[model samples]
Target: MKVVSSRDFNQDVSHAKRAARIEPIFITDRGRPTHVLMSIENFRHLTGQTETIVDLLAMPEPRDIDLDGSRPTTWDRQAKFG
Candidate 1:
């Protein structure tokens, strides 16, 4: 892992980004580590994160949903006569 001060990172952001592709880069502020820079693939792999619900919903519907009156679901109900 490469360590760089915030000033250095700010001065050469491009270089830091390039180095991050190879390994994580630690960014420091006032001599203490503040953040990390890493490739998106690496980050995802480390976190094991998956696509969110919004992402799934945004995708085109793969099949048509049947909402015909032929099938009644549990929600269907009737009022009993007094």
Candidate 2:
């Protein structure tokens, strides 16, 4: 883990970004930890959420989806139940 003050990070964003690729870079404000900088891949790996709805839809022939080919049956309004 690498720690960088907000001022330093702001002054040298390229270096901080480069360091982030290797590991998380903790950004501090007023000598206190405030944020983290990390690669997108690492963030995705940590969050365990990489796929989007568009990606799922783009998949070939998903098995779980049920497609209703017929029109929905109309409800009978005359029938009443308490």
Compare the candidates by TM-score and give the number of the best one. 2
* Candidate 1 structure quality by residue, lDDT tens digits, 38-62: 9977987899977779868998996
Give the count of colliding residue pairs in each prediction: 0, 0
Q: Taking the tens digit of each residue's C-alpha lDDT, what string does model 2 give over 1-82?
A: 8999999999999999999999999999999999999997899899997978987798799586647846446655565442
Ten-residue stretch with the least lDDT total in model 1: 73-82
Clashes of 2: 0
lDDT (0 to 1) per candidate: 0.89, 0.89
TM-score of decoy 2 = 0.61
